[model samples]
Target chain A: GAGVSQSPSNKVTEKGKDVELRCDPISGHTALYWYRQSLGQGLEFLIYFQGNSAPDKSGLPSDRFSAERTGGSVSTLTIQRTQQEDSAVYLCASSLEGGAPLHFGNGTRLTVT
Target chain B: DQQVKQNSPSLSVQEGRISILNCDYTNSMFDYFLWYKKYPAEGPTFLISISSIKDKNEDGRFTVFLNKSAKHLSLHIVPSQPGDSAVYFCAATPGGYNTDKLIFGTGTRLQVFP
Candidate 1:
């Protein structure tokens, strides 16, 4: 793809519902990252994937938040039992390698009603 | 606690004037710094970056200055353009080694008026 792409640009889910956000990274990108941002807030690290494996899941906020990247291309983030606090913009970025400048997607705005 | 802070929530500058955005970090271990520009309804774009070893880096109209002792960094735009009006975020990481997750500041909204 020309740039990083994320699906479901806007999502409105009810509390306690499960929502899956998808991200498709640029071709040949070796590093993928997930970040969450609240309105007027800074980006919060969620998880990082190097290749098809994720070595740094330390940033996941809770057990309900999980992500997996397969084939080092497409990634999915699943949040079980969504809460109002989870409402924010979920951003995905990919880079050629770690420590390189990232190419970001428009992001998925999830609103837990 | 917020490791990185951009105290100024908003900054207004006239076109063709210099625009300075400041950021401060409490974590001395952060050795890599970057500035990003973001417009509404879009993702942030990399603006400029500076390594800890160097105090300043210049790229065209953008320049980043880092003060290790003060744990501060500033981004300067020469002869700011109205098109540069957007939110600017300052981010830092420990180093360019493995496991360099960025920590970003709240961001400062830069409004350049013609």
Candidate 2:
């Protein structure tokens, strides 16, 4: 409740309907990340969580994308079908356990129509 | 084939004058480097870091310069203000400190005029 908190900040969904983006991290900060930013482009690493285990989803770009995290402090990123280039702006970050300055969340602006 | 590159999409500093942002990486196995500062809706916010075994890294006035054999990296924001403008991202990680898959760049919109 003091940083990284993402949620339905904005979601338009429709193309195929199937979206889920949520992240809440900052409590103990054990590492959690999920990046996206289409439109102008850049920040696109797609998965990271060291507590719920995701050694590295290798930037989940396909497989319809999927992400998960649990007791380590909530995380979720699912996109089953939505297309429209899959919109963008998912972003969510957290750090501390291994540390190197990371603390973001003000994302979730998906919008696939 | 973008292995991190901020080919200057925008930059127009003035305020205090001194804002150079540039980043280029072709992945030489990277080695931890970061500089993020976004605005608009707000998200990125971590401004200095450089570690390719060290080329340069400062804080206060914000400085980060690493040119590992030309993999290049630059971020200097000496006096530039006006709230430091906005977008400016350059991140890379070959696992360092707390690496977690990062390799971004394509942001550089500093516009501190005034």
Range of the 10 consecutive residues with the lowest summed lDDT in candidate 2 chain B: B95-104
Residue B80 displacement in candidate 1 (angstroms): 0.9
C-alpha positional error of residue A86 in candidate 2 after TM-score superposition, expressed in Å = 5.0
Scored against the true structure, residue B81 in model 2 reaches a CA lDDT of 87
Model 1 chain B — which ten-residue stretch has the worst lDDT? B94-103
Total backbone collisions for each predicted model: 0, 0
Q: Model 2 over residues A1-35: C-alpha lDDT tens digits?
A: 48888988998979987889999988898988888
lDDT of 1 by residue, B66-86 (tens): 999999999999989999999
List runs of model 1 lying over 4 Å from the truth.
B97-99
